[model samples]
Target: MSRLVIAVFWLLHWLPLAVLAPLGQAFGLLLYVLVAPRRKVVLTNLRLCFPELSEGERRTLARRNFAITGRSMLERGLAWWAGPARLRAMVRIEGLERLNALKAAGRPVILLAPHFVGLDMAGTRLSMEGDFVSVYARQKDRVFDRWLYHGRSRFNDQLLLSRHDGVRATVKAMKAGRPFYYLPDLDYGRKESIFVPFFGVPAATITGLPRLARLAGAAVVPCVTRILPGGAGYVLELGGPWADYPSDDVEADTRRMNAWLEEVIRTMPEQYYWVHRRFKTRPEGEPRIY
Candidate 1:
């Protein structure tokens, strides 16, 4: 089944974005109706994150999210097999000079990427510009994993460190001039994660952002990717480096991270990855959220 899916992706890569995007969205709408379990997860997440929204409003948002999620999945073909010139034309980057300035000054940097639908597009586009390191979570399926790995690292000297590689290896890579593309928002269980108020709910967010930044003496820069509507393409926005981060208090820094993420998600709630069970790992005697 996986091989057949990959084959389909390859065949679909030849189609223009104008044609491909809507087809993907149509497929997404089908998934929203058929994939009841995942559809529930997306709705649950939206309810938790946006309680002020009416139930109808939340459902509307979830449907749009699933559509974009579908588009992202199908668009992996472009990231994996499209020509460099084609991808460069499709992904527009902003504020890259902030990253360049930090590197030019010999400062190790961390590109703090949130889990947006356009994440892979942003990473692949940046990989074309220079080398960078990111953590890779091995997928259970070998065939799909191989294709995902190849798609991500097919560009310039991209280094994908395994989740088990630990902090020392990642810090070393950062010090050696390879910016770390770090995604620190997901709920990675209780270990090394603190309960931070995300959307006014205690979310188990990993403390790696501040720890890694302090260990590698790297500047933390926000990297957000927006998926343009109507098959227009994507925009990867690189914000200026955060100042006075990783203070003496780790919990405080983690709270700051979550607060910043909440603000960003408000800008484009539909683009955020809401399908995941972000609040799965509850504290102590708390009941399971999923």
Candidate 2:
């Protein structure tokens, strides 16, 4: 079944974006109806994060998010198999000068990327530019895992460390001039994570951003990818390096990271990955939210 899915993706890669984009959205609509568990997760996340919004508004956002998520999934084919020129033409990168300046000054960088739908699109586009280091959680299925690994590393010199590789390997890669593409928003349980307020709710966010930055003496730069409306493609934006980050307080720095991410998500709520159970790990004595 996994091989058949890969075959379908390969065949679909030949279609133009105008045709593929709508199909991806339709696929998402189907999932929204059929995938009850994930659909419930998305709605639950929306309720927690956007309490001010009406139930109808939250449902609308959830549906749009599913559509974008579906598009991002199907578009992996372009990242995996498309020509370099074609991929380059599809993604427009902004604020790359900021990244270049930091590297030019011999400063290691941590590209703080959140879990946006266009994440892989941005990563694949950036990989074309040069080598970078990022972490990946191994999928349970071997066939799907192999396909995902190849799709991500098929481009430039991408050094993908497994979750078990730890901080030492990541810092080593940073010291070697490969910027770390770090995603620190997900719930990785209680260990190595602190309960930080995300949209006024305590979310178990990993403290890796500040720790890794301090360890590697790297500058933290925000890297965000936005999917444009219609079949227009994507834009990967790089924010200026954060000043005075990784302060003496690790928890405070983690809070600051979550605060910044909340603001960014507000800009494009639909593009954020809401299907994941972000509040899965509650504090002691707290009931399971998922």
Candidate 3:
């Protein structure tokens, strides 16, 4: 089944953006209507994060978020199967100099990339520029796992280590001078997580970013990927490295990371990954939010 799905995606990779864009939106609308569970999750996340927006406004954003999510799903074909030249032509990157400067200075770098719909596109483009190591969750299906590993690692010098590899492995890679592509926003339960205010709500945020940066003596560079409307393509934005990150206070550093993420989401609320159960693991006595 996984092979067949990949085969279909590979075939769809040939479609021009003009055709795929609308098709993806239509499919997303259908999913919004049919996937009631995920739709509820999206709505729940939006409600929690954007209480200032009216219920109707949140609903509208939820629908558009699903649309972008679907488009990203279809566009993965481009990231996975398209030629480097083709992919490069579709991306407009900002702040390459920041990354280059870090590399030139031989500073260990960690890209604090949030969970955005265009994240894979950003990673694919960034891989072409320099080598980086990142942690990835494995798919349950073996065939899909193999496809994902190859698709992410096939271009440039990239290493997609399993999430189980933990901070030691990632820090080791970063200390070796390879940038770490870190996405530490999502909730992975309370084990190694600290409750940080994300959009003013206490969210179970990972402490890995500060821990890894401190361990590797890495500078934290913020990275964002925005999906262009009308299938125009994507923009990969890089911000300057944090001045005093991973300070003596790990929880404070985590809170700062979430604050930055909130600011970025305000710029493109619909593109944020709202379908995730971000607040799933609540405080011990708190009621469930989703």
Candidate with maximal lDDT: 1
Clashes of each: 0, 0, 0
Q: Native-vs-model 2 lDDT?
A: 0.92
Mark the 10 consecutive residues where model 2 has the least summed lDDT. Answer: 147-156
Deviation of model 2 at 102, angstroms: 1.0
**Clashing residue pairs in candidate 3 (N, C-alpha, C atoms within 3 angstroms):** none
Candidate 1 TM-score, true structure as reference? 0.98
What TM-score fits each model? 0.98, 0.98, 0.97
Per-residue CA lDDT of model 2 for 90-148, tens digit only, reads 99999999998988888999999999999988898998888999998899999889878
In model 1, which regions exceed 4 Å deviation?
none
* Model 2 ranges off by over 4 Å: none
Poorly placed runs, candidate 3 (over 4 Å): none
Better of 2 and 3 by lDDT: 2
Which residue pairs of candidate 1 clash?
A: none
TM-score of 2: 0.98
Q: Which lDDT values do the candidates have, in the order given?
A: 0.93, 0.92, 0.88
* Candidate 2: residue pairs that collide: none
Error of 1 at 193 (Å): 0.5
lDDT per residue (tens digit) for residues 1-290 in model 3: 77888897898889987788777887788899999999999998888788899999999998999898988887778878888888888888999999999989989999989999989877888888878899878889998887777767877788888888777888889888889888889989999998889888889988988888888999999999999988688899999999988899999998888888999999999999888899998988999987
Ordered by TM-score, highest first, the candidates read: 1, 2, 3
Clashes of 2: 0
Error of 2 at 85 (Å): 0.5
